[model samples]
Target: MNTDNGLAPLRHRNRWRFSGGTVDLHRPDLPARTATLGAEPAPVVLDPTRTAVIVVDLQNDFCAPDGWLAGIGVDVSVLAPAVDLSAQVVAAARAAGLPVIWLNWGNRPDQANLPPGVAHVYDPRGTGEGIGSRTAPSRAPVLTKDSWGAALTDGVGSAPGDLHVDKYRMSGFWDTPLDSVLRNLRVDTLVFAGVNSDQCVYATLVDAACLGYDVVLLTDASATTSPSYCHDATVYNVRQCYGFTASTPDLLDALAAARPLDAGHRTAPTTPKDSE
Candidate 1:
């Protein structure tokens, strides 16, 4: 199906494979593997020291009941499981000493950087209620950088050692230092978790894969308010074209297994309940 992007395969393969400056998923070595609908596989072991967990757009505005999404009438409760799973993933990743990068929609203070079309999508009232614009009733600014709305949700916060990237677009790489930061830290494998699985999270994963970073989507750790079919499509697209789909438990088990015997393999703790 031409899943790979035409890069040379790695000599020592594990669950993640490299091709044409992008990351590809191979049949994972772990006994409990996450389903990917149907995608071809190669293999590469995950290096904890060189891996990162990317928490995408799990901010107050998107996750909290009083936040933007809720205020806009979207059923925010759908993300409850995802929020819990994300917290667990963060906790485990932190314990494992893996870098946790929180990628969020943190727009500029002046809102000049927000494109009109993007602003219009969220500001349906035409009442100056746009990105960085304050809602009249609650006075919550849409998602200004450094604002409460832009902060990571209470349960899933950035640890002292974690990194934060304020992304202005759906894709984390757009005018953001995410790519450079990962390269600088020598992080080639990325585990994704966050809200709106079919949107922001999906966009960022695709970008990460295209930029040559191995990507894993913790399915249970991400949620989307979109229809069930939309979520399915996103997962299928990721497995077939971008990367692999795994539950938090699958990844945690893999990390735990790798910790004891090999320095190349690091940590993660506990199993996640199925979020589905």
Candidate 2:
């Protein structure tokens, strides 16, 4: 049972209670799982059990045709690839026993927590077409909590074990319970797939790395409405500075072989040059 930490009757990983005298800081009896992915700058090999997949800001407001980005004249069609790959990654993660977290930009209805600079950037002219403003014809507030604009896009489905976190800022960790949730789940690695590769996605991934979580950015599973240069540099920096960058297929291949699936692409584990 690998009961190496505490008394069997009171052991818990990342959890403790002052029971009688001894506390149970032992991690639960979860199976240790690992897999390898074909990645850039290096191949990726990670523990699926200690890892989580975070889909950031793929909400209707960011990717839907009639949503906030589109309302602001940003072409949302460019997000199709990201949406598809993210959906696939999320499904595979659920099957692999890895947690799937949807980090969406669902702001407070009153915009009480929204900073003035953020509000100005949304509606620079102060014309009331910004976040939480009923500027659109349908009058649904942009990214308001529990609003249609804050809902997941059509193709992204939520399963029973999936976790959802709403963030007011670009980084999901800031002013959110994201970090705490991940820690309690015993997640040490983050696989990110989402929109605005250079913006929210990048910010979250960077913060994840800074906070000591291993980060993997799925290249094909992320997209940016901005120019190609922004997307290119984001990937480059992820590999060069933050973490590794791998394709969606690589991740899926790793998960399938690592767990029960028999139909996923498979690859042998390889050591990255730097690690060797």
Candidate 3:
């Protein structure tokens, strides 16, 4: 079916061709491999040196067992697993000397810059009873924006080399400094992990892909208010539209494989006399 953007519908067609007791497509270049009887292959490899891991909106409202949304009937069971997987991904990226950018939803008290209809969906109470109060302790860079309940929740801080970019819309690229930050870091690939897979995460990935960055969504490192929505948005839509989706193990393997060998090179040691 067509989506809200009026895109064409997807079709499923199965055609069988046999030649010499083997199935083949019309094209000779098409291998004799079976098309519908095997498991899907792993995602493509992503170079760590040219990659940046973006942790988006992992605040208490979404990740914590008790937060504003906790009162709602929203299913949050996936938050813990997503958080755990994200931590592992972050560790791997750090080890590889890649940049880790944390995108938090920071809101202002006045709420002047929030998007037009955002606050209607998520109203911020006077007591900070919204998405802004949730925070993690990873010290990742944070961007605080007053657009909706978009401020990074409390308790999350920035690390030694993290960056925070404030945004005013669902996509991080809309009038934000995200592009400049990625360009400055020489990052050509984006590894996305975060909350609301169907909403913010989906928008960001689509925008990144449109901006020509190789995007990979850590499927296990992100979630939505509903499991079905998360799966459809992250696993299905991202794979079909924006980029590839991978689990933590799959991403770790890709990063490990992308590592460079030492080439058996060694550095010379300094003399003891020179120390004196």
Tens digit of per-residue lDDT, candidate 1, span 213-233: 988887789989999888888
Per-model clash counts, in order, read 9, 0, 18
lDDT of each: 0.72, 0.81, 0.59
The number of the candidate with the highest lDDT is 2
| Position 124, candidate 1: lDDT | 68
Q: Which segments of candidate 1 are over 4 A away from where they belong?
A: 1-44, 260-276
CA error at residue 113 for candidate 3, angstroms: 1.1
User: Which consecutive 10 residues in model 2 have the weakest lDDT in total?
Assistant: 1-10
Q: Which is superior by TM-score, 1 or 3?
A: 1
- Overlapping backbone residue pairs in candidate 1 total 9
Candidates ranked, most accurate by lDDT first: 2, 1, 3
Q: How does candidate 1 fare on TM-score?
A: 0.77
Q: Quote each prediction's TM-score.
A: 0.77, 0.86, 0.66
Q: Answer with 1 or 2, whichever has the higher lDDT.
A: 2
Candidate 3 residue-wise lDDT, 110-171, digit = tens: 55676646654554454443333343222221223433233333333344455666555667
In candidate 2, which residue ranges exceed 4 Å CA deviation? Answer: 1-13, 16-23, 259-276
Candidate 3 lDDT? 0.59
Task: Put down candidate 2 lDDT per residue, 139-253, tens digits, no spaces.
Answer: 6798899887888887887765577899988789989999998988888989999988999999999999999999999999999999999999999999999899999998989
